[model samples]
Target: MAQMRFITALLWLLAAAPLAAQEDARPDLSIREPERGARARTYVLASLIYKDAEDGIDRFPLAVPELIQYVEDNTELDVRLRGEDRTLRQLDGITLLYMSGNNAQLRIGAEDRRRLGRFLQDGGLLYAEDVRPRGLGRFRFGDAGRSGTPFDRQFKELVKDPDILGAGGSRWRKVPRDHALYSSFFALPDGPPPGAHQPGTITDLEMLEYRGRVAVLFSDLNLTYFWGDPQAHSRAPSLRFGVNLLVFAIARQQAGPALR
Candidate 1:
């Protein structure tokens, strides 16, 4: 029965994906200043929720679910979905931050994922969203422009905060082509398969190596297109790249030092 349900879902998605999605469908995010009130919290429990929502509504919400369904059908893992939001930074002994997800292995600790972006326009750095906002491989799927996205402003604001950056310097650099991530599950000789992947026009995935481990991974393209694209299940590079990324997360965790 489970197998049948899974297969049915896949067929439904593939049949429903509109060709318009193939266009530049990634929404341009209108990330405003973090509102003055107590604030609404958004945390992704991995497969359940991939995009972050400030007003409780993500621009393109189909990517994560489509991606999750794609993973289950193609891979052996059966994911348990859970997506929610919670308070942040309130701590007893100097606040502690952690991220949680079912599909993606937990990084800092357990249970807490804000939107794909914590950085917002005119707000404190890294402190805006999830815990330990260090650099990482990141992307703003909403807008493709190199600059002027809400995430760009928010991230820049976070970078300025000394408390946020902590002692470790920004080891920000392009993920080396030979890094294990490229070939974690499937081999991509070039690099991250772009969402709006166009010939001669692409961006490298970036990462923040804090201490001896990779703290963050970022992408600028809306690789989400692959999630719902009709060619997803086939041999789409974006989908394959997404799979490679999730697989690499486990590999990265295994290599990181013991968690506190």
Candidate 2:
């Protein structure tokens, strides 16, 4: 275990260094388009299933694939979900980690937290959601049930360690109605369209920012459920919002940032 401890210590040192010089330590989590006149690109999106997560981790089974199909249908990008979504114990090769669940007691062990830290330092986006069961929006189970709400202290603890996630001391805020996320791809003129939950439960999306980019975005909208259920209300807008979110997360890398 001597080598392992040495490597871990090295990673901590790298985290304190410049983002540019972190190439060797950081995981490669970039999604960019091919060069002009070159072949188009393909992306594989997946959800994170952390350890000790028995329930809610895979709730709304059809959510991810449905969202992927929606993105491909509406945008120029070719996106597909890994088979049944990635059953990952590690974050290697993941540019965006879609972590959605409503279980307030979600528990991630120490090792996975370190993996997340390295992933964020590598410039990955963690898009979390509270996927309320169909027609069960009110089952919020009080504050803890919501994945990313400012009041969900349990979820906050998951990422509170700056030494672990490089985002210590951060807090969620109401994403302003004028935030570009509303119009990244589709035009959300009035801000995020209403979520699946009851009206006004959330006036806007909440985000945790880091390194000048959105490190985590939490929503109580039950968006994935809406996308999966074909008969659900506001299904179209939900899919549209999904596309906008995916585009915004990777747009910076698509611009050919020199970090990689």
lDDT of each: 0.40, 0.59
Per-residue lDDT over 1-260 for candidate 1, one digit per residue giving the tens place of the 0 to 100 score? 44344333333333332232323654443534323333222213232222343221222234445655666667653334322233432221111111211112212211222322221111111211111111225532223424334553444343334443433324457778977667655668888765443334337766554333455555545455445445444436766776656544433322222222
lDDT of model number 2: 0.59
| TM-score of each predicted structure versus truth | 0.50, 0.72
Question: After superposition, which runs of candidate 1 have C-alpha atoms over 4 Å from their true positions?
Answer: 1-59, 77-148, 167-169, 197-202, 228-235, 255-260
Instruction: Give the CA lDDT, 0 to 100, for residue 46 in model 1.
Output: 36
Write down the TM-score for model 2. Answer: 0.72
Best by TM-score: 2
Clashes of 2: 0
